[model samples]
Target: MKLLLTLCFTCALLITAESLNCHVCANQNCSTSTSVACPAFSVCSTVTLLRRSGTSTTVTVNKNCSTLPSCPSLLGSETEWSVNQGFAREARRQLCCITNDCNMRTLAVPNSVINGRQCPGCASSAESLNGSCNATVSCEGVEDRCFNSTTLNSTQLMIRGCISNNLCVLQAIFGDLLSGSIDITCGAPCSYRMSTLLLTFAVAAHKVLL
Candidate 1:
């Protein structure tokens, strides 16, 4: 009887050890779903990014286990994380939960509202994409920002577009993570037509990497 009790106790411990699980996916099909045992003391998270330019919009979602601290949304009760990348003319939202399989639900993407703001817009990479801005774009929703992003010892990336006002508040929450290599500066509407000169980021890096 003693041996049997010991075996049963061991089995219970094993089950407890394997209880934590989370879903994992990366910018893949919205219908696709899978789950795996989460690492010890980890929480399930979901990161959703929405990119819009011209008249087109795209959605990207990523779900997985994260050890990062839970980010509570201050803007609203349901929305946990949101950012308007004025530089790249993109927007993002995130949700984080601790309950098992809590991240399985789909999140609603907010609609863009034109706020009469404008800024330069363009995209460039080492590879030939030839992204350019013919003119400034009208800002909508929370997109009332002008942003600049520069990489260190690498290609220069610029995003001039409308961004949400909440983005500035969110940036403060991340003060613990910013580094010299990566800098994001955001402000108000820019000139009607603005463009950035492609240069070795080694020089621009000096401006932000203080």
Candidate 2:
């Protein structure tokens, strides 16, 4: 009788442990979907040029994340672990965007005649008039905003740049784990930490760009 009781107790304990373990996996997937859905500024709009002259330009601006589903709700239960995790993920992403200095590489334009006019000189005096001028120029201007968005399976984070022209620029993508609504629970800390850490690693390694 003692042996049978001991076996039964052990089996019950094992079952409980399995249930808890399942929670961990579920939480991880949820957090991942949230991160995937987190919208960055780039994904919302494409780069535009309001005015481009002599290697410089002034771009208009738009900074609204309402269209994105992943935009974190500032009004939700702040104390909840999922909320904290989401905020933390956003913070870590913002850090990466700032620290990594993710911007377009400006290619030097060669001095050449465009439509029978001498083209303006680039920073480098050496004009590429003789070389092929087909190279496209990618410049970084001010008024670029980043934000988060929610989606069905993944969160969409984007960064939209306002250029001189009236056009939307989609800059980058950060796919997270959660989608739709996030679960509010204490078991989300690990998921949040792991997701942010993965983002940091990808940024550092240049696998992900802003």
Candidate 3:
């Protein structure tokens, strides 16, 4: 009865709010973009994820309705935050707004914040993106989650080190977007092993500075 009543209330809210309209695209410029109606319970979003090695960087952009709880609406630039582990780093920027088709502007990677933390992990490139865990990393701001995950398919790729909570949500939801079995574990617990030789770590984050 209680659950039913809550559902009823939620449904009433959605009926009043209707559905949000957002842009849906990937790896495209959105300066002058088109729009599409989102699902019954989602919000407009433009999320960008990047992985960098030394001076080389790769970026992927996605615009669609999101159900992520963390990224509400910043209204401005992305938090100049990122995560770095040894040879590789991961950074994210999001532009979200409430209204009809508000995801405009091509967001650039903001300035990085040096929070003075260190971690260890492995990273790879989009091209030959599978490598062994043979690196120590420098953890960045808001990258409170230490990730150690792998893709369990024909081509198994292992990923590790500190990461952001936003990436956690995306990896969980879109782990299988590529053609393979992928496992993404961030800020894991203790240490585990995908196999005998392959060891993974999980550090408990407390009063995490994001």
Candidate 4:
């Protein structure tokens, strides 16, 4: 009977070894966290999110277990979006690893610097729902693409902004954690004017030479 009890205890430890363990926290500093075992093929992830409206910026952090296949490549990467030039913005950074309790790091949002591309901008509010987005904003940093996003929840909130090329990929993987279940549609490249003008100038010079 004692031998059977010992074997049962060994089996339990073996089962626990097969699962990944990760720290879970949802505070700005991640000062306190709890370790929990994750499901099969899971990885430990730590994410930081920043939301800005005008001069007010709010930062939040969450660390937990994730099953995203792209987690490995997404480590230490950040994405950003903005509306009204710099009036409203959002940024997220993620760190993911496959080893048990490996996501012990924390991330913070980076500052924004304008990159000169322009896009129509509007914040999510009653006025924006009417499609009266005549205002434009200078795109910032790696945010060379324009985007229109609407939440899938009952509120159906809408926002138009500038974003990085990988923002969409992160949104697809992170879902509600990034911005809720958002339906995002990206617009055409916003920095085409300079190229178009250069092409026109080259053509004119060729005609003159002929």
Candidate 5:
């Protein structure tokens, strides 16, 4: 019984060692005998398994290894990626205006001049018809004028614009990384990378709100 137990322990240790050993293949095409291995970035084609009989034997086999889809390769876990993407998408949506009324506008007359002033004719053809005003009566260049007629408030517009601009800038900087423009580097662990990016985003957002 003692001898049998020893044999079983030895066999278990050998199996554990074999399982722990990671033999990365060099060539895209690899066999059990080929010692060369592919780099970390390259796709793995097959994994070699060793069988211990009277003598150790190498077993060559093909494996169905799937590659990760191309996306912004931000260093983070899946949850981090999801949160960042959600924030970015929301910011973009807030920034973009589908209707003509709520869109951002540049004003010829500053907010200081138009505040608390009720000049209906200020935006009427009557002003153009009169000799007093030579310019067209349109709300084209004025942000305050645009919002004055819309359901949104000045503060809301400002916040939306700020958030959207920040999101766009970040997206532009990390677009390639997110869109899988670069291959995944093993050195930048996903969790660490995500924390750093999220921290930067949060800081920027806080500053903007302040």
Candidate 6:
């Protein structure tokens, strides 16, 4: 009887260990998030992104369960870009926590200050391929490396921006673990555009790395 009781106790511990709870929300307001059990091997994730296009700016926050354990390697990374002065320019940070509902707190967006580096910035889609940009963005903060990435999923999207060296390397190392594959190429000298150089890619907030 004692052996049977021990087996039952072990089973209970296993059950508890298999379940993880995390807060889930997609809105900027994460204060009213719902708690739900995540799948086995999943952890809580909080992602904050700030995007700017022309004169418009938006901040977005998301919390959910994630299975990618390597995502935390990008904890404080930021990207900057401008496309013809009116395309989607973004700065993003991600956080991963192992405790239940640990992602309830929202992360702040990182600020963009001219870091004296520059990169070619552009975006394209299958429907409307711009192919190139005449203007280049002066990179900000730790965005010392230039990158070009193409989405391999159904979206058919391509992005070019300035990224930190660590972010670029981590993305390459963990590219296989992400949801969808992205072909990323980094490095290359960014020359100024004599006619169309713009400061449109400046970030909205200060250095708020996760």
On TM-score, the candidate that comes out on top is 4
TM-score of 4: 0.64
Badly placed stretches (over 4 Å) of model 6 are: 1-17, 26-28, 69-86, 122-130, 149-159, 170-182, 189-210
- Give candidates' CA RMSD values in order: 14.5, 24.0, 10.4, 9.5, 28.2, 12.2
TM for every model, in the order presented, reads 0.54, 0.14, 0.54, 0.64, 0.13, 0.59
Which is the winner by TM-score between candidate 2 and candidate 5?
A: 2
The local distance difference test score of model 4 is 0.65
For model 4, the superposed segments whose C-alpha errors exceed 4 Å read 1-17, 26-28, 69-87, 149-158, 169-183, 192-210
Clashing pairs in 6: 111-205, 111-206
Better of 3 and 5 by lDDT: 3
Query: Compared to the true structure, candidate 3 yields what TM-score?
Result: 0.54
lDDT of each: 0.53, 0.23, 0.58, 0.65, 0.24, 0.60
Give the better candidate number (4 or 6) by TM-score.
4
lDDT of 6 at 170: 64
- For residues 30-126, could you state the per-residue lDDT of candidate 1 as single tens digits? 5566787787656567666676544567777777776534443521134522333333335546666556776666666655665555755443222
| Candidate 3 residue lDDT tens string, 99-162 | 6777655566543555444455764454226565666555665665566667777776665666
Candidates in descending lDDT order: 4, 6, 3, 1, 5, 2
Q: Write the per-residue lDDT of candidate 5 for residues 3-119, one digit (tens) a residue.
A: 996785565334333212123333443422222333232222222222222233333332322122221222111111110111111101111111112212211211111122111
For model 6, residues 80-162, the per-residue Cα lDDT tens digits are 22222125455656676667887777776756666666776653332224445444667765566777776677765556667
TM-score result, candidate 5: 0.13
Which regions of candidate 2 are displaced past 4 Å?
Answer: 1-51, 69-131, 134-210
Which residue pairs of candidate 1 clash? 87-159, 113-140, 113-141, 114-140, 142-164, 143-162, 143-163
| Candidate 4 collision pairs | none
